[model samples]
Target: MDTGFNWVKPMLLMIALAAIPSVSLGAGLPDRIALDSLKNLYDSVQFNHAGHIRLLKDCAGCHHHTTGNLVEDANCVRCHQNSSETKVVACRGCHAAQPFSAEAQRKKQAEMKLYHQDKPGLKGAYHLNCMGCHQKMGGPTGCKDCHPMNKTGEALYNTGSFAPKKTGKAAKEH
Candidate 1:
């Protein structure tokens, strides 16, 4: 009767209890996330994931109904009133990088969900979600606020002498 498994039950119980608080307090969440899907013009955003979690104290604020939290937006509540948590909670999981691409457009058209017909692309989703909140909360709102533009972006936009010099037929076309 000298089995060594006597402590297993109590140890498991302690671990389970310890995990509950961490999950609720955002202890295991990533401290930062790189939002690089749309990094053509700007550098990948060093998203302060943990900071936002601490500030907002609610995953549903950004993850929406995917966090198993109640939907507050009238539009989202209409259909997702009883929406449960989903496995894929990341924005990129639902919003595509090239949402307007032919393949993406075809897939969107094929989907039966009429409610998500006009779902914005991943880039648009970030801008829409962050910009409005920032404006209201007195956070950074300029284009360079979150992700500063790279050298290529400056050149493309004709910022100073960084603009590529056009010659021959290219110049005439413009």
Candidate 2:
């Protein structure tokens, strides 16, 4: 039987194999981002990319498909909670009072004068785990190594700033 389908099978296999390499395409990070000097980053936290991607199962899995943006949640619990209310608990509750804790900030500021003081703080572990893996994978090993603090990460999905702008009769106009 000289069926044309026999040749088609091999051709399709070849095409699929070629596509596999294309799937991993990455040119490089955007130019808008700057290198992580470490000095420029005191308050800015490190982001662990390798660790986060492992759990998410590629970018498409957890990110809202409709939006196609990386989430900008500073903490993990914020995204895990029901209906994305703000926190697994509360924003002000976890952060407490000011955007930065007033009391803690005061305490840290008080110790700013002391050399090598261990100020209290919490950071996303994804930063460590993911960055650790990237270095192991022979990727960049500094702050700029994985992220651009000044410019927004396109993959990171966020809502508040992206929300539709509402405009009409201002409260002042009334």
Candidate 3:
């Protein structure tokens, strides 16, 4: 009745449990994301995270590091992992602020350009990721669509703007 097989069941069960991916890991998804880490030259991009989640199939659509399943917080070590603590890297941490001197600014710009040749600056990264996805999904692809200008022609924030534009024949019919 007991031929050392008792341990095998428990061992197999443990393995199976370990193999099962965590359904609820990492930080909970936010309804909205105000990207104001960097100084707001333009309006802090008001990201509708909840809406995006509904429209997209997977969390990985926005969180590139994620792989369909919910990502464990421990695994987010690629960007800002310290031995003592884990932290999200701020844009300014890498992308230095605009220099005051013209020559210094030019040099800094060149350096940033080279450093982010593949990765790109904060604005560039946002444009490539957000705008690219919007374009692919047949959404708005205009400056005013994301960053609406004020009556005086300055970028405005939280003014009930930044809605996706309706277009095409079907949109016209409506």
| Per-residue lDDT over 2-46 for candidate 3, one digit per residue giving the tens place of the 0 to 100 score | 986889999998898676444323344456778653434344568
Q: Which candidate tops lDDT? A: 1
What is the model-wide C-alpha lDDT for candidate 1? 0.82
Write the residue-wise lDDT of candidate 2 on 57-146 in tens digits. 455232322122445554533543333323232112332233247776786688787542442122322344346656677756675445
Please give the distance, in angstroms, between residue 162's alpha carbon in candidate 3 and its true position after superposition. 21
| Predicted candidate 1, C-alpha RMSD | 6.5
Report how far residue 96 has shifted in candidate 3, in Å: 7.4
Candidate 3 error regions (>4 Å): 1-27, 36-42, 66-117, 151-174
TM-scores, all candidates, are 0.74, 0.24, 0.44
TM-score preference between candidates 1 and 2, better one: 1
Instruction: Quantify all predictions' global Cα lDDT against the true fold.
Output: 0.82, 0.41, 0.57
Winner by TM-score: 1
What 10-residue stretch in candidate 1 is worst by lDDT?
20-29
TM-score, model 1 to reference? 0.74
